[model samples]
Target: MSRTQRVDRTAVRTRLDRVTDPELDRSITELEYIDEIEIEGESVAVSFTLPTAWCSPAFAWMMMTDARDAILEIPEITDVAVDLRDHMHAAEINEGVNERLSFDAVFDDADGDIEAVREELDEKARAARQYRAVSALLDGGATPEQIVGLVRKDLTIDSEGRTTVRLDETLSICIESEPIERYLEKATATGVANGTDAGLFVTPEGETISPSEFETVHRRGRLAATNMSGQGHVCANLAEARIGSASASD
Candidate 1:
């Protein structure tokens, strides 16, 4: 066999950390879904298990593909093998993902295509992250009017991990960068805040939020955040039990 280029293990992990579970909108690495990472020269094999054997097949397919794609981003890594363990659709998902087949092609009975599912999840994630980001700004003494009026150009992030918000010609506020940065990432990706002149925040439907409706939109964002986190907590608990059971069997 031909030898492949050397790869950095830490760099691989960091890339994998960027791949999130679609439903939870959280990192798979943080969710403890990654069971093992094996490397041989430039190729990698990632083995992961979900909280349940019957977890949604579409969700599993998304994660497996995402994991493979993330690892391949490293220039040195030539190939990636994603192994989905102990799931009802593991066989189909693994085969489809490794072979680069479409999700619909592999699972003919799937009600909706993967991209639609992904878009929906992305919208939810954008909303949830927006809630936290807006909360951070509010706590930093920003008002609803100031926040709703923000545009892409009004925000700046520095190397020191601070986000400076230019409220007006004479006033600006600095806040921790993490929340705003995270929100901006999803917001930009979903095209909700894509242009320099576009509003920085919007309703989950991608409409500009009127000042009168800002409170309602914020509340919905909070609910979206709550639902995702609650689901994540349940998955975490179930995953723990599942892992423990496997260990005892061994």
Candidate 2:
């Protein structure tokens, strides 16, 4: 094989980073689920293991499809295979992806638009992101009404104050303002109304709510955040166990 035909590891990894786990809206790579990346002449094979063998077939298919699509984006690659390991539906998923079949084509009982699912997840992620920034502002002594009326320009993050929230060397995320950025990105991507009239926070339906309704919205957002956090904890544990077991067996 010519040197030019070899896969570019860095480019492939960067591409994979954009392919996220549908449920968590997080990169599979960041979750450390990618088990292998093999380059053979013009073909590149990517393999990943799930947190559990019985993980949702829908989510498994979503990741596999996204991964294969990402790899195909590189003009240099002519062929790619996405492999899902140790999962109950691995065979189905592998065949579905390798054959370029639709999700419903592989699963007989599947119904409704997959885009609906993606949109729902995107909304939840948007809410979760907004919750972080709002809570941060609240802790910094901003009022509910003030938050409800805020525009993007009204937002400001003081690095020192954010660092103070960490207060420990191990707390690396305290100073980062990704939540706000994520919220904005999701908002823009989904075409949710933003700016002075609608404020930084908007309903899942993409409409502006009154100041008096902020409490209810804020409380609901917190609950959504809690549920997402709990799910995240469960996934983290499963990933740890799966990764550990794989390592031991190796």
User: 1-250 in candidate 2: lDDT tens per residue?
Assistant: 7655566788889999988777777888988889999877778899998888988888888788888888889888878998898898899999999999888888888666677877887788777777787787677666676667666554445654342222123321333465666667777667663653446788656668688888778777787677777887799898788767776754
Q: How far in Å is the alpha carbon of 111 misplaced in model 1?
A: 1.1
In terms of lDDT, the poorest run of 10 residues in model 2 is 163-172
My TM-score estimates for the predictions, one after another, are 0.95, 0.75
Clashing pairs in model 2, backbone N/Cα/C closer than 3 A? none
Expressed as tens digits, the lDDT of each residue in 1-250 for candidate 1 is 3554467678889998999999999999998889899988878999998999988999999899999999999887889999999999899999999999999999999998789999999999999999999999999998898889999999999999999999878889999999999998899778887888899999989899998999999999999999999998898888788778886755
lDDT of each: 0.91, 0.75
- Global fold similarity of model 2 (TM-score): 0.75
**Judged by TM-score, which candidate is best?**
1
Error of 2 at 162 (Å): 13
Candidate 1: worst-modelled 10 consecutive residues by lDDT: 1-10
Model 2 accuracy (lDDT, Cα): 0.75
Name the lDDT of candidate 1: 0.91
**Candidate 1 deviant stretches above 4 angstroms:** 1-5, 247-250
